[model samples]
Target: MVVDELNEGRIGLEEMKVGGIFPNLKVFKNKVKEYAIERKFVFVPVDSKPTKYAVRCKDKSCPFRISGRISLDHVMVKRFVPEHTCSGTMRGNDHPLVTAAWAADTCLGLFPCPGDVRPTLIRAYIKDKWGITISYVKAFNAKIIIHEKMCGNAEASYRILPAYAEEMERCNPGTIMCVYRSRELWTGGDSTFCRLFWSFGPSIRAFSQTIRPLILINGTHLRGKYKGILLAATAVDGDGGLFPLAYAVVENEMYESWL
Candidate 1:
């Protein structure tokens, strides 16, 4: 699911009551971390377990602390001390709790297209929106994390090609799907993916009967971490609209690949 906003009516550190209930431990932890980031404070975990979680202000002298425990499949806050006695000097641009995974999830909505997400843009966005300063490496890592979350990793995607082709053929009986692998499979138990081609049954029939005779074949470079070319075939319908007929992904635009 796509998350559009943060803190969206969810309870924060200040708003949390002693008996407040959170859906799960992850939600409770995320809320606390987000609160810490927003308030420019630091929290150190005092007690962390499967059924219980506890944290106090980074400053040992501070009296602010909170703890929650799992109760009947939900985490219930058992202790709450929202006030802090120490001066907020431990907070700064860098936060130890802000991880790449957390940043990726927090700003997922900003990355509609993974290709356009640059590290510099991510850094600027986080700084401007959340008042948090993250290093370039963290921003770059966050981009990678978001890319994998949006589109599966390259290795996993390659491994599932055969299953995807089988499922496609099963769903559309007349669909044509093919996966080619390189001959080098001795070292790694999995075969190296070379190319993939697919065409839907409905699209083939529509192109043959209703679409225009003119076929436009074009090839574009894939923008993911893997370097490849995306070859596509489309036909102009009666309304001057392009209708997709087939697609192929190959290591390069070669005669054999097109064939």
Candidate 2:
């Protein structure tokens, strides 16, 4: 589990000093990256191990460096030289520390709502926040990176449908969720996702009680890593708003799939 100190505003890179402690090596590395990116500098890890970490400014002549070692499950900075002799203007357009994952995390921190953010917004946010201009491709890749992190890989999501359906039924009685597999894993020695149909108890009850009798059904194409189709059953509410009823995910929108 990540330590609470890793949360935003709990700690800042400028606060790092000699003998400072970090929850783990990953946090330490990330802090260093944030420090370098924010200052428009570049650092190269001289040594990175399970228990120890060391980095120096990319310019060999620069004195900016940090070294840490693990102690009691936390990394303690043993040495820190916060002095830079090289001109910090070496960075052009983008810094080496500004990776796709870093860009994604920064965008998520600045813009908490994922659905409301776009690649152009991500590019602008990075430029405004870090003074680093990344390519459109990089911003788009950052979007993809965070999307996979928030919503797991498509293939893995399909594999967890059975358990998800079970949990849904347990949490909300009268919920209808079905998962169809191409084959039984134990008996057939393999299994693959074929289709899924789910209708939450709340949505079902709400539609039955307040929605219009007329229902509109539609299917949309999934353009993610895994290709499939999403079928949704929606009803018009008294306010003329669409009320979600049931949904299905299938390989294709065919007669059997609708049934």
Candidate 3:
């Protein structure tokens, strides 16, 4: 029955032999890792070499493992022990559903409207989709990981602000872009990023031509690694739709920052 299920693709099998001309050990290890994930088991690297690699189950109690060595022409499988002595319960951390890629896919459409992408919502979504309940911390971490994947790390993004602003100005003429930085008095090193303000040319044009004179200003506190405030100015269009005019990221939501 197990062999039939493996043959029919109902269950993934731990193959005793893998024949391929892999470019490197990293590629071979990744291929084995994918196979383990498909079989609902976590792959933990035991050791590796220039032409050989070994991997085992993430569970210390589980005795499943495989070791292979690279040959001149192809990768040679020296040993394949496919039997797992585990208790048959999947660990939350090792499960395929609790991954960064899974989180990115789960929160794909909710990137723009961040307010709707709460941990509770993500937990419910996972439960609905996979019938598995994940903890709040896992869900929250997923949210952060997805944001990092989409927009890059918050601190690192600051480092590229100057180039980003310059590129925007070059691509869209008349775009208002500014990046401010301050040198630390004690360190005397490179300038540290302080604030960034930008307004696209098309948004400025639309605000001047079609948007109402009435403008609404709002600010939100960022909850990422670097703490700051995102201040935005918006106006209503002729069709009574909210039109974003400009935005700025500042260290604090003070009167000077608002100005």
- Per-residue lDDT tens digits of candidate 1, residues 1-259? 1111244344544656788777777777887888777777889999998778999999999898999987656788899888878767345687777889888877777877877878888889888877889999998899999888888788898898899999999988789999999875677665788899999998999988999999899999887678999999999999999999999999889899999
Clashing pairs in 1: none
| Per-residue error (Å), model 2, residue 163 | 2.6
Q: For model 2, what is the error of residue 234's alpha carbon versus the real structure, in angstroms, after optimal superposition?
A: 5.6
| CA-lDDT, candidates in order | 0.83, 0.83, 0.71
- What's the residue-level lDDT of 231 in candidate 1? 99
Angstrom error of the Cα, residue 198, model 3: value is 2.2
Model 2, runs deviating above 4 Å:
1-4, 7-10, 89-91, 148-153, 167-175, 184-189, 199-216, 233-246
Residue-wise lDDT of candidate 2 within 20-65, one digit each (tens)? 8788777777888888888788888898777788999988999998
Over 4 Å off, model 1: 1-9, 89-92, 109-125, 150-154, 170-174, 183-188, 200-218, 233-246
Query: Which pairs clash in model 3?
Result: none
Give me the runs in candidate 3 sitting further than 4 Å from their true place: 1-47, 55-64, 71-75, 84-135, 185-188, 202-215, 235-244
| Distance from true location, Cα of 105 in model 2, Å | 2.6
lDDT of 3 by residue, 1-259 (tens): 1122112222223444544334445445545654665456676778777677888877888887788777654465666777788754466634553565564455656657555567787777766654567777778888887777667787788888899899999999879999988887457677888888989899899888878898899999987688899999998999999988899999998998988
At residue 128, give the lDDT of candidate 2. 88
**Candidate 2, 154: how far from true, in Å?**
3.4
What RMSD, rounded to one decimal, does every model reach? 4.8, 4.5, 6.7
